[model samples]
Target: MNIAIVGLGVIGGSFAKGLQAAGYTNVYGIDVSESTLKIAVDQGMIKKGFIEANDILQDMDVIMISLYPNQIAPFVEQHKNRLKDGAVLTDVTGVKTTIIEKVSNILPSTVDFVFAHPMRGSEKQGIIGADHKRFIGANALITPIATNKEASLQLIEKLYKEIGFDQVTRVSPEKHDEQIAYVSQLMHVLSVAVVNSQQASEETLTYAGNSFQELTRIADINAELWSELFLNNRTGLLKSIEHFEIELDALKHTLEENDDERLKAIFRQATNKRREWY
Candidate 1:
């Protein structure tokens, strides 16, 4: 397959390398930066690199767009005509409802856009941080619409698995967003909150333990990208935040009342619920 990846940033670069590792030699990359494209080609992650979509869109059998949430729809609209007939297009956007609706409306009948979210990433940014190994043991979620072809959905799932994802599950776009808001976005928010809640001190790390370090690792985030993700899924994320706040308030009340039994019960409940994931 002639696979083309748009936006040769961390995720895109990782996809290129992973696909090549899986023996897909016909991979290509498209990016706005000439330096990024040159680096991608020099590193042999892609067979060739294009600075613009018009240069390679027509020849690709599969197009994996690894752009920001806001950019996904526009990129499709701009190059929808250029995409090859019968091509399978997919994206790695974190939030999906708006993007799916917009792209689905504008997509050509000949092509299929299979919406997918690879549950893997790094705190680091750009192509420099790309690592195909990140997908190992990670889960991937596919939000397929009624119009999506079964063959195309299967192709996407197979590709993700071949590139190292351990599992791929299909769910409604609404469910995907709701779950992600809690599991992914809320985790990041908590990390940031924990980091910011600390008093500023250069010596803070000296007192930190493994748990503190691990918990705040994602606090070193891509602010602009995360801000967009938070805003795009505002409704779902707000609901998640409200739920978390309620739990936090209950804990605070328990502490105020010096209710040791209640605190222990709460901890036990949490531990039991968490153990189920394993």
Candidate 2:
């Protein structure tokens, strides 16, 4: 398969490496940075690299857009004509409702765009931090729109399975955004808030336990990338935050009223719900 991965950042670079490792020989890396392209080629992540959209992309069987949410539409619009007919286009972007709606309107019917989200990442940035290990046996979500082609969805699911995703669950864009707001976006928000709430110094970190470290691991985030994602799905994110606030207020109320039984009940319920995941 001739696969083209746009934006050679961490996720894109990881996709290149993962696909190559899975025996896909004709992987191509595309990025705006010439140096990044050269690095990708030298690292053997991709068989070829391009700094700009060209005739080479017309031959691509699949094109995966790994750009930030805000940049995805412009990238597709700029290179729409260069995309091959009957080619399957997919994305690893987190936010989907707006992206799926806008891209569907702009892209030609000759090509198929399958919107997908790979629910795996690190707090690191750039191709230098790319690792295919992060995706091994990870869960992938295929958020399909009404206009999406059945064949395109099948191709993307197969591609994710081949790249080592253990679970591939399909959902509508609405449900995807609603659920991700809690599982992904809201967690990032909580991490950032928790890290910033305290005034930490060297002395404070010296006493940090594994619980603190685990909670704050994702606190070291990429602001530029996350800002775009948060804004794109602001409504759902805000709703998730509201729900969290309600639960937090309830806990605070229990503590203020000295309701020991209520607090224990809440903790027990939370523990039971979490155990369902395992």
Candidate 3:
């Protein structure tokens, strides 16, 4: 298959490497940065690299757009006609509802857009940080509409599995966004909050332990990308935040009232829940 990856940043670059590792020889890359394209080709991650979408779009069997949430629809709209007929188009966008809806409306009937999210990433950004091994044992979620072809969905599932995903589960776009808001987005929010809550000096981090380091690791986030994700999924994110606030307030009340039993109950409940889930 002639697979092409658009926007060769961390996610796109990683996907290219993963595909190459899976023995895909016809992989191509597209990016705005000439330097990034050069690096991908030099590293043997892609067979060729293009600075922009050109005639190469016509030959691609599968195209993965790994871009920011807001740029997804616009990229499709701008290049819809350039995409090959019957080609499978997919994206790595975190939020799905708005993107799937908009892209579905604008996308050609001949092209299949199967929205997917690979549940793995790093604090680092761009091609320099790309790592094919990140997909190993990771989970992937596919949000397919009623109009998507069964063959296309199967192709994506098989591709992800070949590239090292442990599981590929099908889900509704609404459910995907809702669950992601809690698990992914909420986690990032808490990490950022934990880091920001402290006014750190050089000595402050020296005093930190493994737990603190682990909690604040993702706090070294790509601010612009995360800000867009947070706002794009704000409705679901806000709901999660509100729910967390209620739980936090209850903990605070327990502390203020000197309810030792209640505090112990809360701790026991959390421990049990964690044990059950993990």
Candidate 1 regions exceeding 4 Å error are 198-200
Candidate 3 residue 199 Cα shift, in angstroms, is 5.0
The C-alpha stretches of model 3 lying farther than 4 A from their native spots are 198-202
Worst 10 contiguous positions by lDDT, candidate 3:
196-205
Please report how far candidate 3 places residue 51 from its true position, in Å.
0.9
Clashes of each: 0, 0, 0
Cand. 3 Cα-lDDT: 0.92
| Candidate 3: residue 214 lDDT (0-100) | 91
Report the CA-based lDDT of candidate 2 relative to the real structure: 0.90
Ranking of all predicted structures according to TM-score, beginning with the best and ending with the worst: 3, 1, 2
Q: Report every candidate's CA lDDT.
A: 0.93, 0.90, 0.92
Clashing pairs in 3: none
TM of each candidate vs. truth = 0.97, 0.97, 0.97
Using lDDT as the measure, the top candidate is 1
Which is the better candidate, 2 or 3, if ranked by TM-score? 3
